[model samples]
Target chain A: MKRARIRWHILVFLTPAVLVYTAVMMFPLFNTLRLALYTRIDQERVFVGLDNFRTLFFDPIWADQFWNALGNNFWFFVIHMLVQNPIGIALAALLSHPRLRFAVLYRSAIFIPTILSFVIVGFAWKLILSPIWGIAPDMLDWIGLKSLYAPWLGKEEYALTTLALVSVWQFVGIPMMLIYAALITIPDEILEAGEVDGITGLSAFWKIKLPLILPSIGIISILTFVGNFNAFDLIYAAQGALAGPDYSTDILGTFMYRTFFGFQLQLGDPHMGSAIASGMFIVILIGVCIYLFGIQTRMRRYQM
Target chain B: MNKARANPYNTAAMHGALILYTLIALFPVFVIIINSFKDRRSIFREPLALPNSESFSLIGYETVFTQGDFFLYFQNSMIVTVASLFFVLLFGAMAAFALAEYRFKGNLLMGLYLALGIMIPIRIGTVAILDMMVATGLVNTLWALILVYTAQGLPLAIFILSEFMRQVSDDLKNAARIDGLSEYAIFLKLVLPLVRPAMATVAVFNMIPIWNDLWFPLILAPAEETKTLTLGSQVFIGQFVTDWNAVLSALSMAILPVLTLYVIFSRQLIRGITSGAVK
Candidate 1:
């Protein structure tokens, strides 16, 4: 009777949150996946299982845009993996050095961008790089490389890469903070032990600290993958929903937005939007599951 | 201690790389903020210099205040962020406490279901959610942002709160229960106070993204009366594209408040993250 009473209280307390989260999140999520299976017919939806997917994959018009965005999304993730994580890790390493000067100031300054709204950062960069303003050219001129300045955001070849770099600039502090936290968790005695073994400085960081923080690095990697694949705001803010200079900067997030909400000539397509959302959900889930089951297990096996 | 000559090379290298990167990270903000206080000619001529007596001007800020509803947008963001933070923490903590303290049937399953949202972005439900909002006529209102952010924030809120709530002293709670206090009274008076620190941590975590988000504001509540600071500034900056003064000022108006808050709370914020409040 006492045990049952305890269980009843737990049920009563938990019921509301579970119910609300379920009613709002679970039902809609499943409904989205379900909606993706069907197509609109005369503004009347018809259940066409897997036909949307078939069209998305095999149809030429949809296929070209779909594959282009997918490939760009992959490249986006790759750039972040190559650029953001390494820079973040390097910064974290520097900040974590013992008795570092003005560490807090450096950290807060570096992290201000991460806290900034994407709208602010995106527009700030757009204005700073504007040729009319000549801020970019002037700065390059100061460094004796004014010739290097170009309308990067306006060029098809450089637009996506430039935007990706801007994103890296804004959010590098996330992985920096995460890895810094992980680094602080490492016992100082371990590092001292490495010193006793004649391994110090750069060598010790590689042979000792790197191994200890692999799990954290793994966590940051998966988070980056999920985040980059779902990115839209910066692009949308910097280059509107059409993601111009000729859709060269288009990724899945902006594409999904444009598809869902008509931009200029396009009509809003709820069914196709849901299909695109379903695709994003699958991609994120695959990355997360791989982290949870695959990478994490390996991380533990190699744990110090 | 006397080996300055020995280690000077690496130390110089470390300082060089760090200071360079820090400048790269912060120079844009520096440029915008400085230029926001300068005449257009001065801004174009000297982007790097601090505003001296001759250079300092409020032209940009004058335009920002006169042309845009800066205060109203700030108020909307505050209302939405604060309101969502309240419901998310209260409901989330209560639910987290129960899940952590009890070993009921399907407890693990319930936890995993809540965990699902942590991986999946809530924006995926935009189609149905927008449909419901439109049907209910809640779009273009602050309440829509409140509800969407509540739903969006609750999952991680629950996850983080649950992790913290589990560590609350069972002995203290049991003693309170033995004193003939009802569960509701015990929770309201005792457990709530105890978990305030953890809730603060979760609040900081939830606060940043909600304040910084641009998508939901653009999609759900882009009315003149309802635009958030983010969306409002984005639109304002876009309109003033040719007016560098207005654009820089608008950007400063958005960034300065957040920067001030960050510098004030930097330590607490970092502490909150490293406190294992979520873990």
Candidate 2:
């Protein structure tokens, strides 16, 4: 009887969370994956195994859009990996300096943008970059670079890159804070030891601090990959559901949203939407598996 | 280690770099908020300048208040955010306590299953989620948003809270056990107080995304009464795309509450991150 009471208590504690989570998150995720394997025909939901996948790959109309969005998504991830992470590291390094004045002020100021919604970030950037307003142009003119100004967000050549840079501007704080946290955890004795051996200032950071924080950098990179791949709100808010300027800014997130919901003319197709979602799931799964098995395992051995 | 070796020139350069980036981070927000107070012509002509008596106008605010149901949107957002956060904390804490305090069967597996949500984006299940919501008659209801946000917020909350719970000094728990305190009481009266700071950290972490989320709100609850400030502003701005004043005002209205809350809680927020709570 006493053991039964203890077991009941445990169940009581776990039940609400488990039930809610299972019903809302886990079940829906798996169901969506299952839905990917089936299609509908003439008002009847039919189980078609991998036919949708084949259509997505071989069907020219679907293939073109999928490949385009996938390519753009990869480019988005690349910009974040290349530009966002390095700048984040540089800022974190600079801010983590021992004698830096107003460090907290700088950290807070830099992080303020991160908490704002993508709607705000997207619209704010849209207005600033609008050539009609001349804010960006006028500012550039002050630096004798007025000729450099163009309607970047409207042009097919620069639209995605512009949006990516704006995203970087908004989110650079996350990696900075994460890396700063890791940088501060390095033991002072390690830095002192390096100092005693003629490592100081720049070399102290390069030779001592950077290596210790590599694991944190790895974690941040994986996070960036996951976040970049799943990103939708910014593009949707800035360029609308069409990811406009002829879909130059379309990524997997927007593509899936459009396919799932159906834009003005296109009919909503859940089966194809699920297929695209499943494709995203596979790509993300591959990226995560590579990180876990490939990067983290090697980093673990190096840590000791 | 002397003051001279600190390199005054290097310090100046570092400050310059930080100051420049800080401007880049804050300047856009600054421009929007200031321009919201200006008349249309001035908004374009003196976009970079601060508002003066001649330039200042309440027309934008008047338009936002008149043309949009901002108050209802704000209340809707508040209800959804607060309700979801309450459940996320209560349920997340209970689950975290159970996972941390017990060594029962499937403990590790359960933990790993919960942790999977951390890496995977919940948005991938949009199609099924919408279908389930529609089937359950939850579509276009705040409950749909509340339920979804709770699920979205729980995994991270449990992960962080459980990690903190494991450090709650076994001696205290043991003494409470010896004192004839029931397990639930021990959790409520003792453990809850102990992990309150971690809970606060979790709350802050969960609160921003829940409040700012546009995807779920746009998908699950786009009804007039159910519109969140984020979605409402998105639609409002999209409709009034040519109205510079209303657009800037709408953007500023969205920016203010979040920015104000951020400023108030920024100390705790930064402490949470820098204290290695996140890492």
Q: DockQ, in order, for the candidates? A: 0.62, 0.84
Cα lDDT tens digits, model 2, A164-190, are 999999999999999999888777777
Per-candidate interface C-alpha RMSD? 1.9, 0.9
**What's the TM-score of chain A alone for every prediction?**
0.96, 0.97
Task: For candidate 1, give the docking quality class from DockQ.
Answer: medium
Model 1 chain B scores worst on lDDT over the 10 consecutive residues at: B1-10
Weakest lDDT window of 10 consecutive positions for candidate 1 chain A: A1-10
- Please tell me which predicted candidate would have the highest DockQ against the true structure: 2
* Candidate 2, B214-246: lDDT as tens digits: 999999999998999999999999999999999
Q: How much does candidate 1 score in TM-score?
A: 0.95
Q: What is the C-alpha RMSD of each candidate to the true structure, in Å?
A: 2.1, 1.3
Q: Whole-model lDDT, candidate 2?
A: 0.92
